[model samples]
Target: MADNQFSLLSKRRFAPFFATQALGAFNDNVFRNALVILIAFGVAGLSSQQINTWSNVAAGLFILPFFLFSANAGQWAEKFEKSRSIRYIKLLEIAIMCAAAIGFYFKSLPVLVGVLFLMGTQSALFGPIKYSILPQQLKPEELVGGNGLVSGGTFLMILLGTLLGGALMAHPGLGTTWVSVAVLVIAVSGYLASRHIPLAPASNPDLKLNWNPFTETVRILGFLRGNRAVLNSVLGVSWFWFFGSMFLAQLPNYTREYLGGGAQVAPLVLALFSIGIGLGSMLCEKLSGRRVEIGLVPLGAIGLTVFGLDLYFARPEAATVTGLTAMEFLRAPGSLRIVADLLLIGLFGGFYIVPLLSLIQTRAPRDRLSRIIAANNILNAVFMVTAAVLALVLFAAGLTIPQVLLVTAILNALVATYIFSLVPEFLMRFISWLLVSALYRIRVQGTDRVPDEGPAVVVCNHVSYMDALIVMGCVKRPVRFVMYHRIFKIPVMSWIFRTARCIPIAPAKEDPELMERAFAEIEAALANGELIGLFPEGALTRDGEIAAFRSGIERIIAARPVPVVPMALRGMWESMWSRRGSGVGRMRLPRRFRARVELVADEPMSPSEVTAATLEARVRGLRGDAA
Candidate 1:
């Protein structure tokens, strides 16, 4: 029923925030572009070098506020309702635009530059509220789609603003007057949209306001150190900004120097790249089945490296080209490949960034979510600025734009490998998700019964060697499986299991020490508020029938007394991984492609009320005729 991510636009909860943020982005670009154009062309009696200096100063001024006041913005968001805060920010936008209009009328660079700093401050104040409000508004399953739309909308608006603002500023009849009017109008529209946003209560109503940006910024980043996933996601996102800034900063130079194209060619390249990003962001929802699938991160990294390398090679020698329009450049030999490479890089960029943003929104502590986002903004600004500096260093070192592209591409590969290695969970989940989606069509029922957070024991009927893999893939939350030690050590699957932190256990008769260790580990995990999954059947079924439940579950639950959830796996016994014919001999057999598998879960049983026999019956009933 929910086929398209755009469907969210019709809903009140999402649409208003979406409109408000999109318009804010549009206005930001419009004002910035108009000011840059006035400096470049309309300014009276200024040297080319002085104009360039002023432009650079303006650029640095815009980014400086994100570093200076984001911590205070985050604190304000945490201390008050987000919707109210957004309205206030939008009001500030109107005031800024009013000031900008006056600056544009006077054609004063200082006035416009000051307005730019205020614009940056406005954006910084809204940053945390914009992101932190999403998780509170959308369902978990809808997060990817919501984020995709937001990303697409933001970039699309940027492209539009760039085109429109430049057009309006250079227009014979309109000039500064029209651009100023547009900004003020858009600012008012943004405020009107913000009025419709649903009320979102402060996450930490009692959070103390820390107005000192320096100390608070340090404290905010310190909060991230405790959350490895959130911290890593932040780093990943920052790297993306770095990569993007480097690529974008080189586009004009690349078009002019390498492609022998004019000013128009830069915009053409930008349209291609930004449009590619928009489409790719929307495509993420479809590829991920509307879930926040971090698997796309690795996939994006791969594309970035591959297309980036191709882009370097696609660079034709400067001698082979002459000054050409964008259309002519495209019609030229080797240009289409270059364009394709740019598009794919943008596509992969969408794949890379949308998930990381959603991951931070979903995984960060709710109370500190805004502050964490502030930290992310600060890091992103730092990385982007560093990327600009690195480009300067590279140019000084005599590296051409294409050579720099090659280096960035290689660096992307190294960084991706390092990050994924550090957190094998990302890769392991990707592998498990890939295998499950490729080999079986999973239909999960009663997913809501699984606790969204906190500790619980998931007891399921074990039907085949692939059972844990299937469960791991389908479950929304990360889980630790208790598997037989031999199965835990089985080939490539063993590596996946180890990376996933599955507990390996042996029966008391075989190894008492191992058995004791397993229980101890399970208890520790539960105490730490993690999910522990176990196959109460102890081993895979031999005759497509439910095996008698093992009493180990009782001991495990009795020690911890957490809720026990009963789950069932059906239509798996006939799969090649099952011992349907030759028992262990069937281990090497191949499964039918895309087997239809159903994983059904039932209500969680109170720990005090659950027993081996009762839990077994519950799982059997859930499995029914399929077992």
Candidate 2:
């Protein structure tokens, strides 16, 4: 709609927030990498074991604040205007950077460690404010793109920071001085950028700030249970973090032990992975047609598992050669497969996370969006900790790095399967999307004529058995279809139909009771302000032409009195599922793959104006000889 996701970068509303967040990420990574470098090489008078111990301690110190302060941070974000809070948070970062500068200059390990803890605290507080403000600042249609750009920029900055920090810290005397100066400058720049961010009003101004983390954590998680979809999506996102953490945490060892690479190679591999994720995230806006399509989540999960397993198998047979650098590894036989696996794994991760983040913002109650994001942060920390523990357990059990990767991949499949089973809408949407995308290239027109929210009846001229699936894929929102009972019972599609809660009707003469119940359910759904879709023609066209509109449309409107939106599907009677012959005796297989099909919606008619004949004429005019 706005050219592409990158167009958002030129706009005033999103640009400042983008720069501020990216700078924050860059500063976080630079400081962390600087600390890691100091422990590994710069710091003196410490044994290798002691260095490892301190490195682990620093990691814990950083993550611990997320566990302790996320709940309170969530409350703070909701209780205050977000831009104002972010400005103050950035100011806090400047002060922390000053402390870090002093710590770096003095080469005092204790000062640096304390400064790292404060940096982590700053991040924990900023997490909720960042996500909750997007819904307030952008339109619903812009959310996915905004999130994509944010995610891509954040990862890109992280890669840059890691590279720059490692390079700067390795220098002789100017290393510490330069690192301190860079961090301080970045911190000041971040604060300046925050100044331009527009004010996002508080989501829950009256919410009491809960000081106790333990009790507040439980209460927030409890509140999250109010929406299973939101909660499950949050879990799904956390699992990705768990999966990603395993790869990132073990990458150095993996590069050394498995690929026989040096310190430089691990960072190169990380860069490749980061680039892949950024590309995949930017592509989501295009793949999803600028909507929050949860269908992509299952697709992403499948890719995550598949690519992860391939990565395990992709490990090249340990060559007799040693000291292979990243460039040499790339030149080696079979190494490209490993690189491809990592890149695709990161790409799938982008697809998996962006929509889920958008879902969290949109599906969670507007009044408590920040708290829910906080709950997500807490759970993400928990999941990441569990992943570390799991990796350790696997290593203790005598598994190789590749074997550990294989196990995580297998576990990912099991977990994803279990999650999808619990929430079949994701799977159903994926299936419908797959079916339509595989069979035809659909062009939807007048999609905006359908209300974005609220109860409405959509009547389309049904041309094929795949009508509902096509509609489901095109419509951004989920719709409950009122379909034929026989069609609903189709072998493989039955499961999807049942999961979608499609209401199936039979002819009154054949099954009066079923017809009555179906009508009752449709009315109840309408009463609940849910979208209900039906074909007023009642059955698929037998001759690639619109059949006479049935009186059932009149009955539906008379009972529910909701707006009736007339739509028409053209170029579908020739599809595989259509009955193009004189009778069922001449049913044929799919005639074309990737055929062009169009769905056109007319302006919604008021209840009093939606006569069967009038709706039929409107649809016919919209179809306009495209049959």
Candidate 3:
């Protein structure tokens, strides 16, 4: 497996699909923006009212297919091979663009609008196939990185398409002609690229087709409710669209009226926002250590709110000057602050969304993943429409654009809080991630040795009080650590332990009943196919040396008869949380911050081979001299 996500871009499995999707996005925006420009500029020679009406109608036409056809689209994606379905979808795009060409050649507003609707239908069909195919093609460890690339590429293409489309339509005579040709060529190019995508077999080959959009939409939504975490993650995704659309819808007006900028400044504002998202999306793999770290979601939500609120105060009043170009706006007083706020909002938005998509992909039932994504598409459309309606209502009540943005930012905080409350795992993971990352520069190895899905026992050396947090942060999956009951009760750490579902165990001598309960719980967790993390040393090392393993691990394995994975934590003895010193002086401030640490894992041993002494040796060897 490639350690870096960008490495996937050079491989056949990902590169072709990336090209096809990026080109398709570019074409869609090129056509849409061109049509909008044509109408707004009276190239269609219509009355002002007609132009306004048609512009609104064009936006509605594009979004309508996601609402009307997403149900059937989801079923088709599941029932057919994904690569072939992509080809067919691209072929449909070619047909739509051909029609759009004719519409543009004759300057027919109605025909162009109809072609836009067909384009939406093509996109709606592609939506489910686009995401559901990732897990099929990539390894579990690569999912987050893959998603980051896709997300970043998408926004980048949208920016490029928007710019190109507007540029083509701005031409003197042959602007429409240029757009029509560009769309056709891009459509054909996307189809050709789709041909290179590796075959992805149908997820539900025998799935009964559902042609009824209304009933299937309702039925598929029920799939979401089957998993609460998955459902909320889906909601989180839709809420992002709502938040994004709200900001995007107001950006043009905000740039013009408040920032005192001309037409050029709107795209610059968009570029800053889009670039931020792209950069943030790419950073997720590194920040998350290449796991689907939903911890970043909370961090993202906080940034979105903080920067969004700051945007209003950065320039609460309208610009004192008007018609400044992009560069001029940059030099204006307080303009850089506004620009920074927008950029950071987009950056944090990237941080917020990528992991949620990865979570839905990994957690949603494989056979039904397409339908779940389709349901997500439906909800996204609804939320985007609601955002538009809400904006209008706010404007009707005479709220300025800045005030509306402030309200949206505040609403973002409330919505994020509610969602996080519903699934505290996101918040809990965030806390662990924040604390661990702040204190240590961790290097992880042999994580792939841990089974992606199964029941197993993981035994590691206990070097510090912060060991569990470090292990939890590095491991791709959730771990229920068996910790000393006293450490589990340690003030701030206690809340984290409880929230993470860590099992608190007392020594059999001190509390036999609690020890027995902990053993029983560990057994139950294993039976449910969950990973149980145990520090067989049973206590933090007082002298920075490996201690004798306890018999409790042997007892658990003898009862459960499952595989045991041996792991080690190195260079943690000198950390502030470890019991390395002779006195209470050890509790004082550390001599260093962000100390280097490593978590290493060895292959799993069968239950019969996993004695206390043997597992201890394996862990010690993995730790080596780094301790």
Candidate 4:
């Protein structure tokens, strides 16, 4: 396996798939852009209003197939080997591009538009396979990076294709010929790339194919809703598409009417946005420490709204100067700010989306992930259509483009708030992620020793109040920590702890009933195949030394025999939250900010071989002299 996301690009498993998808995205945009340009410029005897109507019709026709065929596409993805399906889909693209070439040669608008609908059907079929294949090919630790690369690459190719197509069509006499040749070559290249993709076996080999789109759409949606977190993540992804489509749909006009810029300026703004998305997508692996880290989702949401609203304020009025060229527009007053706003919006949009896609892949059932993704595609198409309709309605009511953007930004905040409210986990993780990342630079090791699934108890040393947060941030799986009741009740942190479902425990001497209840909960959680985290030392260390392991671990294990994983948190004793500065009873600010900390895990021990003393010794060895 590759150590980093970019390194995966050099490997066989990922590179071929990436190339195939990137080529497909490029070809789709190439065809679409060429068709639009041909309609707007090449075709004669058409008024501007008619061109506008045709453009709108083009968009609608392309989106229609997703609504009609996504359910069946999902079924096909689940029922057949993915690589084979991809090859067939690529072949279908070849046939479509052939039709496109014929349409281009004859300069037939209806034939070109029909080819666009077929292209959409091809994309709709590819959508489910595109995402669902990732989890099969990559490890959990690689999902974030993998998703980041895919999202970034997709957008980058779209930009390149748009530029190429538009440039080709701008040629006076040979424009159609150039476009037809380009589409054919790109489609053939995509098919060739698809041939290199390694075999990815079908997830549900025996899944009965559902031929009816209407009935299967409902069934797939039910599959999506089976897991609340996965469903919301899908909703979050669809909302991102909605938000993005509206912004993209308005950009040309926004550039023309508001910035008083020529056609060149629109693409410039688009290039900046596209590059920002790529940069932000590449940054997700580092920011998340290469985990799914949906904590970044809320942070992303905040950025999207802030920059979105700022864009409106940055340019509320139309420019007095008309028809400024791209370079001249960039030189105008407040232009850089507007550019910055769009760039940051794209950057945050990348942050907001990558994790949601990763979450859906990780959380959705293996057999039905493609179906859930299909449902997501359906909703995305619906939301995109809704965005277009809403824009028309707002324009009819006489709102300027800037004002409409302002409305979209406000609605984004409201929608994000609603989604986060339903799943407080996103917000909770964000808070912990923010605090821990601010206070410490965490280095996690041997997390792969923790079981990816099934029940286990993880025992670590008690070092500081931030131990759970540090461990939570480092470990890939969610840990239900058993904490001292007092520590669990600490103001703002309490809400996070409660929301994370941390087990609040009291010492037997102080509250026997609470201790017993905590024990019962641990047992139940173990039976339900959830990981339980425990500080076997039972309290924060009075000194920066390993305390003797308490017998409570033994009691818990005796009730439910499960594997015990030993973990250690090091370099935390000197932190602000620890007892080092003041005394065992209080904490003070650290001498150094952003202290370096480490969480190390040893291999799991069977119940028969585990003992409190042995576990403590193992953790102490893992911690070593770090404290």
Candidate 5:
């Protein structure tokens, strides 16, 4: 069961949701695939160019609904029971499918495209409800795994759906009658799947629902701003859509003209692309060990960069390959490289997006989660629209399809660099990443064994700047470390540590002015009920021995009186940073990973129970074998 993907499919709570989602994704592609093929191949004897124009138009219509309707859809998700909403949305899909059947029967492009817009509208309504319901039904540990399944399943369905739709449309027997039959079957199956979903009650039962888009957009942003992590996750989600939309909207053209396979080959390339994303998503749970690891963010960015670059180089030079079916293309050596390159693009996409969504789910406040999702949908729509426009402009500028792909890949690298540069925690995680790799790798236990939603004054032995970074690495909640004023001034690290808002402390004897300011800042931060972290040992151990904890820790705890979590800096004593003979030495800078290190948080102590001796002894005991 653990090894099998279908094991998740068999569970009732998951299966029906999976089926409903799959059906939705399938219907979306079926219509889209049919439309694009109709254009690309001259279905119904229409001119190929006319079909292509209409196909792009159909794409625009589907995405247009998100701009006009996402706000209302988000409200609906929050204002009503999600299961019931799913039922109604499913029924709506059935209606749209009937409309599609009508258009298919008549071979009317206008009616078919209208149905595409209707289908998009239906999906827009489902978007907010779809994500908002998941956190409610899933356990915390299961959230990452659940989201992985959802993303993997959704992308896989897209590939399957694309294949199904193309197959149906291309069939010699797929006249109006056959098309109508397929539509009805898909609709009914989707409705039946929706029927089996377990009821998920509305999260914000008492919330006042707003209907106006302008006011509601403002409301949603305001709601989103309430959680910093959620806000960043939304931006990350929007960026991904911007990134992916650029590639996906271009592939069909690239497949036909650049790969020289022409229209029939478009869906094949897309399926390869979607499958890569599904594979990457499916691997996430195992990679994360079932935790929502933000560290994967950089990994995804790196993968996106490397694979996207290779994909550019993988495109065959324009002459040798004229046209071929999927099999012939696969057998061709160059095509296989292109295929592998594309699969990895999608794989990286999976790595890029899944955790971001999971982050939003886990970090967003419960009450406003739906609204934030709605905002995310709107931004996704915006980015996608921008991508479409950019593709049109770039293609119109007389660049070939392959050139457009190369340009986007380059832009992706530049964009990733900017984001990581802006938020160095992404890079800071890189340092912590290397440390974890080289070390025996201690597991963080009972970290929720700390506090979920309150101020904590954490006391520990100071070892190095890496000490603060390591602790920040292990803890989920952001901590404000009281770093030594001079260490905080280290060039590259200075910016990152300061941005993390680490309080810079100076020893009184060396700099009384800076020391006083540091105390004032510490009090100010603690007075606001923020977590204030500082090491009492004052400096790294000179000979792998704990220094006497300073009195500043005692003063801070006495003044703030928050729960003080005694922490230990184990084996970091032997890390390259701590091995310096002098109290401060140039010998140990943060290496890829130091020889070995661990930051362990012991049980919390009330202010009354905390004393210098008690804190030292507790840190010593927790350090255990390292001590």
Candidate 6:
């Protein structure tokens, strides 16, 4: 499963997973898009008060389940077979589709609103299980590629769903009936596809449950509290949803006012944005070579800023009277730049988000990963709600749609600053990046041999924590670093680790529970199509030579079917903090301005025959003449 990239692409194991994901994405958007159409167009045919009230109800119903049922769903994800769980959920969609038909037939606002809530309930349930299952089905190196595909597939489905929704909603006779029928077909197809999915055993068996959202929310936070990286990654992801939700929600006004188009233009803008994200996501898998490379964070951050700012500047003075075709949109005033900005923004967004997601899955403790996801879901909900409120305030303040977007872009910079400043690992990578650029030049061989995206377990000799940071700096994707829990607690430094979503581990003797959590996190990361970086030696080299490799990494690889991409730190160990005695445990020490480093990749090794011992041996072989 590891390096059999073609095999993975060909097999039932992955195919079913892909179908299931695509179907889910398609269905959610189908229902959501229909509802949006109803509100935007169909509502005008009714009383304004009725429209406002129904819209309010619909919004509340849709969002309430995340607050109410997400905790329980997350619990279920951790306690049962993931595939079995997904199958049952797919069946639930059929019933929801039936409800959608009822709503559309009667055009009953209350019934439709109720179904939207029910749909949200379905979504809430699927959220945890969906993410928690990825690490179980794919290989480590495939996590990024898998995630890239998933993200790419999801947005594509989003586009498809919207397109279908528009087409169906347009024809009075076929609109509602066909939507229900189409939903029914998709849901049934998904269920059938899911039946073929391989079973994924739960990571935690003797786990306790708290169905209560309040108590469960507390518990979920407690799980995140133990690991700063998990907490920050959760924050980073929440922010994406927060900021992204705001951006997507305002498209109607943006298209109408800023771009000088009408309702038709709104979907086009969304299409462009979504397609951009899809394209960017695919590029991550191609760029990163299958390992979770943290460098993508900085890269993503840069793209987000560049495109967001450019989009603001790309705005035209007045709206266009005619609805332009996609190509015509390019010919409109500032339109080409706007489209480019949006697409590039989405492209970088994929790079930014997929790694952190993979990091979360790879680094969270397995036993509590569901709870962690639940916590993440809750946080995401909170941030998204805040985004709505913030948008309302901005709009109410008389800000134009584009102006609001500009403000959002400016806010993103501040948010990123806070997160990165909070977690120095991201900053540390930047520092490492600078050192490599200024002092030592890097020449990578066999870089093409690395999988561009997916969950990957990267094995390299441990010289310093800087080893992970250095690797993160060179690689093109975001990586979830598996590091000692103590190192994760270092002040300021811990923030970087947390923000970068490093998985914290405790040695078995000190805290076996934590060891379990680390494994769970790794599983979750892989499940989310992310990369997990591990130092097989487990600790920094004491005598400037690689230590005996541990079997923990092998266990992770065996659990997740991702590739084991080995790398060599040819020059880092000799430069900055390779101190014989005092350097390993020393804190707050600085090696300011006198360091040189180079990280070189070797070929990826499949987990099929590459046991921990074998992988360790390969890493040792690569360390030749380095120390």
Tens digits of per-residue lDDT, candidate 5, 137-172, equal 765545667787889888888888777777777777
lDDT for each residue of candidate 3 in 220-297, tens digit (9 for 90 to 100): 999999888789989999999999999998998888889989989988998999999998998999998777889999
Clashes of 1: 0
- CA lDDT of 70 in candidate 2? 96
> Tens-digit lDDT track for model 1 on 1-627?
355788889998899999999999999998888998899898889899999899889989999999999999999988899999999999999999999999988998999999999999999999999899999998776788999999988988988899889989889856999999999999999999999999999999999887789999999999999989889999999999999889988887788888878767878888888988898898988777666678788888899999999999888455356678878888888889988998999999999999899889877889999999999999999998999899889989998999998889999999999999988878887787676667777766775588877899998988788889877766767789999999999998999999889999998899999999999999999999999999988888878899899899999988899998999998987775777776456354556678888888899999988999999899989999985
Q: Candidate 6 versus the native: TM-score?
A: 0.74
- In order of appearance, the predictions have TM-scores of 0.95, 0.91, 0.95, 0.96, 0.83, 0.74
| RMSD per model, one decimal | 2.3, 2.9, 2.2, 2.0, 4.5, 10.2
Over the stretch 74-172, how does candidate 2's per-residue lDDT look in tens digits?
999999999999999999999999999999988888899999999989999999998999988886668899999999888889999999898889888
Alpha-carbon runs more than 4 Å astray in model 5:
1-16, 38-50, 139-142, 175-201, 222-232, 262-267, 285-291, 331-333, 438-442, 449-454, 459-467, 484-496, 506-512, 527-529, 536-554, 561-627
Question: Candidate 2 clashing pairs?
Answer: none
Model 1: lDDT to the true structure: 0.89
Per-model C-alpha lDDT, please? 0.89, 0.88, 0.90, 0.91, 0.76, 0.77
| Candidate 5 residue-wise lDDT at 251 | 77
Which candidate wins on TM-score?
4
Per-residue error at 355 for model 3, in Å?
A: 1.5
Runs with alpha carbons beyond 4 Å of true place in candidate 6: 1-7, 43-45, 320-322, 325-327, 430-627
The better candidate by lDDT, 2 or 4, is 4
Number of the candidate with higher TM-score, 1 or 2: 1
Which stretches of model 3 miss by more than 4 angstroms? 1-3, 583-592
RMSD of 3: 2.2
